[model samples]
Structure formats: structure tokens, C-alpha cells
Target: MKALVTTEDSGFGLRMADVPEPEPRPGQALVEVRAVAVNRGELSMMAMLPPGSQLGWDIAGTVLRPAADGSGPAAGTRVTGLADGAGWSELAAADTARLTPVPDDLDWTAATAIPVVGLTALYALRHAGLLLGRTVLVTGAGGGVGRMAVQLAAASGARVVAWVGSAERAKGLRELGAAAVSTYDAEETGPVDVLVDSVGGQVLNRAYRLVVPGGKVIVYGNTTRSELNLPVDWGHARPGVQLRYVHLFHELPAHPVTRDLGFLVQRVADGLLDPQVATVAPWTDAEPALRALAQRQVNGKVVLTI
Candidate 1:
């Protein structure tokens, strides 16, 4: 099958040739690929790996085969979920337990964008305690995870305030149920019961001031400037709010209850979790999308259709 391979010089190149189709190796399943999301984590992995290595996790496909031990996905189910590797192809293999069924109404491009971002949003909001009557501020509100964060917070009944970098995204954020939209600096003036930080650097420091004394602050991704500084006043007085940062991969298939990928996938099928896709490119054009992701030119998750 034709697949996009990372080139010798840290870029994606199409390799239209015979590549071994992945098969379920005990506790795994083989999926007939439909679409996959291009995420920052995959981009960062690309930067660290040698040429021709594939990197991606979110996949929307069909279960073509299940393992003999009956530990893999049942064959012939339309699915959308997370996996470990070989994600940029027409066929991929993953542990069956990792697969999640996709609702028939949603397209693969949308399905491909759900897993990691939605899971991160779930963790961030879960950390924020009693979300129903709270007010939550989401920084980098327009990006993939941030966009999902806003919706999840609102679904749990939190009054959502989204801080977006561009004015154009304000309308979309509001449509997703954000109560208000503002720039990072401007959004800091409001009272926040919880803060979800996607952009790091000064924006994160700025968010620290908005949280109510007993509130919570969760940082799941750093999309802004990488090097971040903490405000001295954040810990200066009062029994300060809780500050916790997370990486989605760190908790996957672990932590017992909260790490339930099955629950997450069920939510996707039920429309409780929504995937926001910024762009979709065929496998042949995935290189451009990868370049755009690396250049920080993308607005949300980019989907590569196989």
C-alpha cells in the first residue's frame, strides 16, 4: 500500500510501493484505514526520528481482522480511536482494546481528530471539580485540544470563556458554547473557577491570576512559546488553587478508571465528544499538511485521508 514516509531531511514524502501491511500480533487488531489526524505530538516525534518512520495515533477505520485470542477488535466494525504506529497508511495495526466504534453519521476526517484531544479535554475538565456551576477559562481556545476543551467544559455545564489568538475563531468558539471570547490578556480580568491552559509562556502565567483562590488549573498542552515562566504571586498568598499538567500518552491504558478508552469512544459515538477537523488532505498531499503543522500554520487537527 502507498504510505507517506518521513524523508531523510525531516519532511514527509510519498512512497508508493509495497509496504508490509500491519497484522494483529496477539492482543491486537488490523484496521482498514480511512483517515487519521496529524497532531503536534506526531510532529514532534517526526522531528526526533530518522527518515521513513511513521508517526500518528488517532485513526478512523474499520476492523478488518481480530487476533486469535479474541483480545482484538471484532472484525468489520467501523471504528475511530487511538493506536500506536503505522498510522499514515491504508492499513494499520493496534491492540483491539484500544479501538473505539465510530458513529455512522460522522465522517472519518472528524473521527480521526477525536481521541487524544477529547481525552485530554476529559482529563482537564475532570480535574476541575464540580463543573456544573463553575466558570472555566480555556487558553489557546481555537486549537484542536482547546476547542474540544471548551465544548467538554460547557457540556458539563461550566460557563465557558475562551481565549483565542485570532478574532476569526471567536464566532466558532461561541457556537461551541463558550460564553465569552477574548484575547489572552483580556480574558484574564474575569473570575475563573478553573483554568485550562493550552498555550504556554506568558499566556499561562496570565491565566494563573484569573482562577479563584480555591479553583484548579490544568495544563495539558503547550502550543505557545515552549519556555514558560511562573508568576511568583501565583503561590504568594492564600491556600492556592491546584496546578497540574498532563500529557495524554502518559495515562493511556493505565490509571484504571479514568484511562478507559472504551468510555471515550462510546462518548464519541454518542456525540458527547466532538472532533474538530481543521483540514483534510489525501495521503499523497499529507506532506504539505505535515509542513503546515510544523510551521505552526494550522488552526486545528489536520486529517490525512488514506
Candidate 2:
């Protein structure tokens, strides 16, 4: 088996190497990975892991073996899942609860884009409660999660406003159902019913004020990695406003991963949702794609075909 593992190298911090095949537990299934998606979370995890550590989450593939407990899909079924790690490999042992059958209509590369970003956006929006006829603003609207958030929010009948870091990233958001797309520094005159902030720091500071009275703010990721300083009187002055930070894994226990993935995959199959892939390259090209993602050069998910 071969996998992309963390390394001490100064470049992408990852390299492909032969590794032992994973042994699926009773509640896990062995999947033959066809593709994987690059996410900021895995890249951030790279710095904390020792050399040779397996790091990956999103995977799309076929089930080589069903779980011993007879919980997961049958063998040979096409599936996409969120693995704890070792997903960027020939095979991965994924929990049955985290795995979902990938519809034949959904391409493997597109299926790879579903788990992390799609699930995160779904969960974040779920935390926002009702979105019908309300305004929902998404910051970092260029990235994978942000793009998915925009489409999902719009589909929920919310008036979507997407905020990106660059004008180049703002392209196609309107077509994807955003009412308006603005750059981070652009002035937004209207208040929103819900604010999904992925870019923290100054972007968050400003967006925080845009939430109308009784609105909700869901903070999932801080791509900017800067401190958030809110005025002391800000919270006091905003009545019924709520601020919530969603950790996908923490929320997963309450939300069925398979059910959510089924909905997303169906939407994609039905042409209601877009995976928004920025690039699809061989697994060997992962380093460059990952670099582009880290630099915020890509507008959406970077998929690596195995």
C-alpha cells in the first residue's frame, strides 16, 4: 500500500511512500481510495504531526470489504467517506458511521469534495436554525467550505451574500445562487440574519457587526489565524444575537454523517449543489495543489486522483 505521509521536508511536508495496509475493525470497512480532497484542516495538522504520520480526511472510492459487524455497505459498492486519517492512500479503514454510498451519477473526483466541506457547511447552517427568506453572509466565500456554504444556504431559501478575499474568487458565486458577492474590504450596506464567518480576525470583526438583531453568527474556521477582538459593548448592545462556533467532529455524534452525505450527494446528482472543484490532478501533483490551497490561490476544493 502507498500513502501520502507527513515528512520533515521544507516543501509540502508530505511524500508518497509504501506503507502497511490498514486492518479494518469490526465497525470499519476497507475502502480502495480512488481520490482524496485537500483541506486546510489536514494541512494544519501536518505541522503538528511527526514525520511519516498519515493525514487525510476526505476520500472517495469503492468498498473493498464490508465491516465485520455487517454495518457498512456491501463490498464493491462505490462510496465516499470521512476518514480519521490515512485516506490519501491505496486503502483506508473508515468507520461505517462516517461512510456513505456514492451514487453512480456522481464522479469519484466530485464525490471526494463532499465529506469535509459539504458536511461542515451543512452542520454550520443547521446550527443557524431557520434560513428561509433570511439573509446569510459567508466569509472566505472562495474556499471549498465557503463555496459549499453559499450553495447550501441559497438552497435553503436564504438570500446569500458571499464575501471573498479577491475579485477573482468572487466569480461564479452569483450563478451558484449568491445574491451578491463582495470582496473582504468591500462595504456591505445591509445587515444579515445569519453570518457564516470562516475568515477570522479583521474580516470577522467587521462581519460580526453585520448580523441584524436576533441574528446568528456561526464561526467554523479561522483561515486568517489572527486574534479576534470585539468591543466590550458590542455583545451588550446586540439583543438576541447569538454566536456559535461549530466543530464538525463534535457535532457529528448528533448529526448522522451518512444521512447528510446522502443529501449532499443527491443534490449534486440532481444538479442542485456544486462540488466547486478548483483542480483535479494526479496524486503526485498534490504538493502543488496543496500549496495553492494554502496560498488561497484556488477558489474551491483541490482533488487528487489516486
Q: Which candidate has the top score in TM-score?
A: 2
Off by over 4 Å in 1: 9-17, 255-273
Cα RMSDs, all models: 2.6, 1.2
**Per-residue CA lDDT of candidate 1, range 1-306, in tens?**
756666664335434445777666787778888998887877777657776676668888998887667874578888876766777777888766667776677678877788778877877677777899898999888778888889889988989999987786554788888888898765444888888997888888777777777778898878765786766767654266788887777766454322355566566667766666777988776678778776756667889888
Q: Given candidate 1, what's the lDDT at residue 28?
A: 72
Q: In model 1, what lDDT does residue 150 have?
A: 90
lDDT of each: 0.76, 0.90
Worst 10 residues of 2 by lDDT: 183-192
Q: What is the lDDT of residue 23 in candidate 2?
A: 91
Question: Per-residue CA lDDT of candidate 2, range 158-209, in tens?
Answer: 9999999889999789999999988864366378889999899988888877
